[model samples]
Target: MDQIKLTMKELKAFIILWSTQSISTLGSSMTNFALIILSYQRYESALVTAMLSVCTYVPYVIMSIFAGAISDRWNKKYIMLASDSFAAFCTVFVWILLRNDRLEIWHLYALNALNGLMNTIQQPAADVTTSLLIPEKHYQKASGMRSFSNSLVNIVTPMIASTLLALTNIQTVILLDLITFVIAFLALLFFIKIPEIQKEKTTQETVLQSAKNGLKYMKQNRGILDLILFLAAINFTASMYNAALPAMILSKETGGEVALGVINMVTGISMLVGSIMVSLSPTPMSRVKVILNTLLLSMSTENFFLAFGNTLPIWCVGAVLGWIGIPIMNANMDVLFRSYIPLPMQGRIYSARNTLQFFTIPIGYFLGGVLVDRVFEPFMAIQPAQGVFVMFFGTGKGSGAAFLFFVLGVLGVVTCLVFRKDKNIRQLEQ
Candidate 1:
């Protein structure tokens, strides 16, 4: 039988946890934004900024499977607290380094790697805890709430970080993140109680064996595996698009840091609206339809915007239409995961799935940087007014990145259309 329906007690607990986490997330977002801006200003290279993603995701990719096993065997609540505590310490370390004027690119990279490990450890535990707390029926609504929090952070962080940077320094931003972490850790430690999942006897299975079993399960379930592979591929393109976007905004003669912040705020507001829409609506019977259709709409609109939009206002219109699909699609995907996967296996399965799905993100980051810095930049740089490349992507600093966005957008749409025809994916929830 499914877990109990959503109750007042559960809702209240979830709210407390959600609120605390959201605050921490907002703080982290601000720090990350500041770091990106700092990195760009220091190096003036897209590759350096993109390499930050590599350092962050490499550890996450390596630890995901192991972290899942650990979460399943251990107490999730404690694991979450420990992870947050470690992350808070890392933030403090960064703050100290900055204060000492000893912070460097390599230091940031190493810290990002450590932070990724902490996040990897926390992700499965935190995710399954949410699933355990909320009933099956409310899964979509809960996901919407999560998305809402994320969008709210994205909407506010850029402007906040910019203001803080202008007034004080990056260390001040890091200090705020440290404070949020403490608040979140205390809330989880004191008030939230996560229920344990019932596990079958596996007396002989070791942690490594358990991870293998998770992989074996995926191999047997072709539908789930196929879905994971599809997402991984599409995510590669999406990552490239994401990594290149700020460059597109900031590289142009007319575009600047302010323009980038404003664009992000607009995108965040659109995502917030989408999450609200999903929360108000009933869960669809066919989640597959929701996922695929949203993917198609987002990819098409985003690419269109990047390829043709010459001004910030034009980009803003595209961002609104393109970003609106993300929360709806993500909420439905979460509902599917909860409905199909057994609770006991979720920690392991989700971790393994995450590794597979995000394995190519680093590659995407590298590829995005290279495409913009080497091939597209040179190609666009030499173009005349009537040249084909300039005609398609305009002629300027960000035009190369814009061209890359167009290409990725086309690829994303094609990937979604192909995945739509996959019998296994269509019947995955069944």
Candidate 2:
């Protein structure tokens, strides 16, 4: 494929797309945070909290394969519109139920499942469309702007959700989310004008043949294959971190709803900074290096802190300090990924990427829950009135098993090493 450059009009189109997504992303984030908090309050277990997550992600695994093939072959615009509208409609319906105080955990499970399915369609479609609308040279700029927008939204959304959860009902936030999707849908329908790519086809080809072609192409692209593997490792470590952090809070020493929200607020702030840096960087390659460095430091430090569970303030401070690495890594990859893939095949490749990346999340969540409960929590409970588990380093009691923090850091560093050694990855930077 020949490289194309963006026109002035196209840049405006990208802005419109970005604005619309910005609103919808806020709703999505609010709902996600609210539900997790609700589940946490009700269940007090990581597994149940993660079950909501599993419902959200598993559908992506199931839908991505077919969605990818269809993404390559379908009218991409309609795909975006349809998925966005479905998501918006679902938000409204769920809001109505929650507002009536009729919503249940199972309802969250089902609605999140629906959310996941819609995302399977929307994510790939928007990414593919970005490539189609913007030229290759501007992909990095587009990525920067997009990440910046995302960080801006994250910075506010969590803080907003926390305040909303405290001051008003969660139902109010859900209602606001409904309005955001409506605005986003209108922007795509009216403002963005991307020309569709129609691949020339053989008269006798079947859907099966086209699907085979994408898979075969993937098998041959060793560079992409390796990058995906390294990404998966990073994702797995993050998943483990996700499962453990919450358990660390309820570990009997440093516990509170406000503290959990505080950590997220910190994470969002750091991510905003990371996104700004990535957006302003001289090149995408430089941004990737920043991402790797931030992760290494954050993972190493956060674990060290999670190990220091003497008080809520101590754990809270540790939580905020350690969380900065996450958004940087996420923003870096979001830019890098969008820069590389073509519009048509994005769905399949992205879906495949999601499958590999998340395959370990369920395992990690379950393991973290069991380890904390059956292994870590019980042991720590006996060691001190506050400890959750005992280890040679000391005890994770009260704050000791925050030892899992160290474990997460170790896993992340190993994955980073794998990424560093790959020559094909170096080539991508160029």
Candidate 3:
């Protein structure tokens, strides 16, 4: 009876945390969608838009090495609260700048960098808190719920932002973010209590040493290391696709912001479907196979169709097929991580995993933008080459990006196949 009561209490806490955080994510997504529109309109360069992601990711990758260790040492709840407060302040600053007509692209870049840094702090702490709240058996379900909220935010934010932009301005979108932040903040402050983790004090070990220990642990656990490395490769290809998609869609004569929004809505719907399936389904026994198989499915469908198809309907079809596997793969990955890593070491190890897995993303974003703007786009504009490339990727403004997507698709598919052969990666199934 007592165990049942305790389980219900923890589940209730998790639900509250999830709901409030989802509300916050919805607001943040709206602001992000609005900014993407504003930035693309103002700069009219793929590199400029991609640089926003680069700035955010660079700081996140750099800070995560230490952030995880700090989270292990500090109180998780306080770390999350502080990080959220800082992020909210950054959002408010953006709103003030917009209201005063003083906002520049550089300001957004700088603020995003700060926000990314804060995320490094909040993410590991939040991960640890979730582990504390939920039983191990429910990790997959919790992850699915997280993915569902994220996908729903992705779907709703664009439509909302597009409507608000049509009706009002960026300021209104940002103000909405502020309102949501307060709701999330109060909910975490008053409604939820994260259980305390007991840690042995090592007075002699420095923070840097703790971070090093995390790396050492990963090296010793070859399966985890291999998995993270594989994810790094996957993230690289995915980042390039992400950076190119906006340029491709917006550059199309027929497809504008509304078309892009519709495509995003389609993608989000697919992901929501995937999350629902993951939440309800029994946890798979062979998580490694699920991860690899889903990657193959996602890479093949999304990039292939996006590369060849020019029409919005074709893009929507590709989007649906490509995105559906993501939540399924991610939920399994979370279950594997939570089940394998010790709860005490999870904060540090998870951060280390993140650092390794996401290091390639900024590089991918930068290279994707540069290659599209300088190399592929210009090359496709030439005569004989344009004629040849147009046969495969249709001629026009986005043809260059389309060609890049084709190359990335091929690479992603090949990478997944090669990684699937690794015995060490497969050993994680045991």
C-alpha RMSD of each candidate structure in angstroms? 2.6, 4.2, 1.9
Candidate 3's C-alpha runs over 4 A off are 1-9, 202-204, 384-386
Give the candidate number with the greatest lDDT.
3
Better of 1 and 2 by lDDT: 1
**For residues 1-430, what per-residue lDDT tens digits would candidate 1 score against the true structure?**
2333435555778889999999999998999999999988888778889988888899998889877778888899999888888878878888888889888999888988888888897898988999888878778888999999998998999999999999999988998998888899899999898887776774246878878988988898888888889889878988788778878888887678998998899999999999999988986888888888998888778777877788889888988988898999999888877777788888888999889999999889988988898888788999898988888898878898988888888898888888889999888757
Better-scoring candidate (TM-score), 1 or 3: 3
lDDT, candidate 1, equals: 0.86
What is the C-alpha local distance difference test score of candidate 2? 0.68
Clashing pairs in 3: none
Q: Compared with the true structure, what per-residue lDDT tens digits does model 2 show for residues 364-384?
A: 666666665566556555575
Question: Is candidate 1 or 3 superior in lDDT?
Answer: 3
Clashes of each: 0, 13, 0
Candidate 3 per-residue C-alpha lDDT over 1-430 given as tens digits, one digit per residue, 9 for 90 to 100: 9976765675899999999989998998899888988998898789999999999999899879877778888888888889989989999999889889999999999999998988998899999999999878778878999999988988898899899999998899989988999999999999998997776663236778868888998999899899999999999999999889899999988688999999999988999999999998986879999999999998888898888888999999999989999999999999888888888888888888879999999999999999999998988888475376889887768889999999998999999999999999999987
